[model samples]
Target chain A: MIGRPTAIALIAVGVVLTATAMVLPWYSTAYGGGVEVVVRAWGTEIVNKPGDWPAGELSPWYGVPVAVTAALLVAGIWVARAAVAGAAGQAGAVGVTAALVVSERGHAVEQQGDFAVGFGLVFLVAGTLVALAGAVAVQREAG
Target chain B: MKKVLSVVLLVLAAGAAAGATLLPFSELLISLAPGQPQTAYVTTGWSTRFGGTKDEHGPLFGIPIVVAAAAVLVGVRWRKVAFAGAAALAGVAGMLFVHLLNVISFHEAGNIAIDPGLEAGFGNGIWVLIGAVVLAFGAVVVHPDD
Candidate 1:
């Protein structure tokens, strides 16, 4: 198992990455009209246009739990009882993120187009993995 | 008391997720160029998904809802585990509200203006989600020591 400081540092880094992912665009597209970006954690533009305008989105809801839980895990890492909660929270956040990734992959495969998943997702999954590892570390030390 | 509270919170979370999915995600007075402004509601499934593009987020709500429901069945007998589930539910639901505030009101697609009014009404479903988060958190706080 890793040292306590390293574990804490990992959680902190995870929080930073997850928080960054939350703000970054989950999906985006550039076209002749202009560049349009949608952050499923928060923003999407609904312009009335007839038929396939060539853009897609995921719910901003996906970003919420992953971010919030990961952020909280940073603090929760300190105490034994809280560490368990932190571990659970980390697991939940990772689970949700993984589901989001899978769901996006599903859409890309089913639909016939270039449904690009955003770069933020890479940060998100990595952050969750790091955070989960940190949580596990903390749990190991506590136990 | 702990078990009952845990069940209540988990059930409430599930209830909120159900509402979030079934009810309109947002009520909007969408104004796009070339057409008269029309009031419309977008469901959690994100109505736009059916159109040119698709949304993966709307359907993803099922995961948490399922987790919450399963947690309810498990009871707080596993207090920490239950609390974690509750905490997760709260995080996700609360953030949906946060997302609402961060929503984009106006944008242009190629020269056409797509403006959902700045004051697009917050739908009932969103409020329920907020409520779910609170209840879920309450369960975490009320959870008894093992």
Candidate 2:
């Protein structure tokens, strides 16, 4: 079983990972003549030259990860107040993370580039850890 | 509390997985000869091409989900042993569904490699279904035997 503070810490770390995932490299490609394109979880940026003009566009799915992280953050805080409810939150987060990972793979595999592991991967691992902690914490509370 | 939550998750997950078939699983655009590119939607476990993947593969991903849901509900209502079976089945179903998505994403739309500039990507349906299944499985794993 996990202690309240420890579970909180796990949730906090998970939330951070989830938040960072949105900005980190989900996918990247370098075309001919120094043209580079990087796709984040939420946005896509194309850099024409190393120090020239870079234009970015927000993906429609950008809000999905942000919303997920926000929920995890709230769940982390809730763990301090109520372990059972927080466990449910953690479980929900785990589901979302898993979904993102599986779906992202389909998109990731199709792209041609030097692909870096996306933030979605980070969130999946973190969310799983947080969920385990929450599960343990809830058992402790119940017992 | 654990049982209730698990049941809810299971049902919702099953629902989402079933719903995914209705939405486009993947989008395949094939540019066979330049300006005459064709777009196709992989919908409801059936593949379609701009010109013609109308394979009558009956609900590629939905049957297992329905079975899992029935198993879960039955397990909760009467036999506790059913939960484990349902979980195992759901896990397998989830993997198969994800694999199907992968195949759809990379495979040629019309049995030939897609041309350059053609797009192939996952749709919202797969995401929702994956998430829901994970949630269901996670709930089962965390459920306490009271």
Candidate 3:
């Protein structure tokens, strides 16, 4: 069974990844005539170009992952059984990931150069999977 | 000491789960005949708006929970079989939690999917159920026989 320390460490790792991705989302894109502008709104990277923006917009929903991470921290520290909090955190992370997946797929129909889902999305998925690993660890330890 | 703590946690969990059963997991518009606005509450949780889900769905999830609660209350008295009772409760609660996950659906749509609002999505009943599963698991792990 995975130990408690290991589980906490995994959850921490997930938090760091998710927080970093959310706080410093710089998914960039190049517009006409060597202009590059990517603005961070909540957690989504918006390509600020006139009449030309990326189709894959995980906007508004982007903040959910970071919020979930913060909630996990609170759950682990105060007013909750760590195991229970971890399980809920995993579910929250997975829900965010699912939302992102659908958002990505719905816009994947048109391939354009201005569209890019870079390290931010990668980190989000990785962070969610890592948190899930932590929750599974708690489950196994109990078993 | 472990048995005491386990039973305490189990009682808390079971009580919460039982209480939540009477609460509305999702709300729906129930029409008696036509054009009459009537709202009905459903105990079994399911997503009502997002991902093409509805408030009305299967309502038979309360049976196993009742049996699990009874087992925890009565079966846990016997120290020799306390672990079995805890395990049973955990199993039943865990399965119900799993089944309730379908309240929200996910898929690729033509446009970016919007997040469901409080009234249209999961209610407090399902949240309590999820937490109860975790507590039930705690009871299972810390049982004296285990």
Candidate with best lDDT:
1
Task: Name the 10 consecutive residues with the lowest summed lDDT in model 3 chain A.
Answer: A104-113
Candidate with best TM-score: 1
Model 3 per-residue lDDT tens digits across residues B1-146? 98789788778777776766655554433333345443443445222232234423234445555554555566356432333334444444443443233322211121122211212345576577657656766776787763
Scored against the true structure, residue B114 in model 3 reaches a CA lDDT of 25
Each model's DockQ score: 0.24, 0.02, 0.02
List the candidate 3 regions with Cα displacement exceeding 4 Å.
A26-45, A51-61, A77-93, A102-108, A111-114, A139-143, B1-146
Error of 3 at B56 (Å): 27
Q: What CAPRI grade goes to candidate 2?
A: incorrect
lDDT of 1 by residue, B67-120 (tens): 654553354465655565665555445444544443322212221335433236
On DockQ, the candidate that comes out on top is 1
Worst 10 residues of 2 chain B by lDDT: B79-88
Runs in model 1 deviating more than 4 A are: A1-13, A19-26, A32-71, A80-115, A140-143, B31-39, B45-60, B68-75, B104-119
Kindly state the number of residue pairs that clash in model 3: 1
Candidate 2 lDDT by residue in tens digits, B1-146: 87787667766765666676566656655566757756564544333334464633223444444455555545454333233334434443444444444445435442353365666667676677667657665666656654
lDDT of 3 by residue, A13-112 (tens): 8767766666655345544555554423163443344443333233344354346444654355332244344434443334434433443433332323
Quick one: ranking by lDDT, best first? 1, 2, 3
* Fraction of native contacts under 8 Å reproduced by each candidate: 0.18, 0.00, 0.00
Quick one: ranking by TM-score, best first? 1, 2, 3
For model 3, which pairs clash?
Answer: B47-B103
lDDT, model 2, position A135 = 41
Query: How does each model score on TM-score?
Result: 0.64, 0.48, 0.40
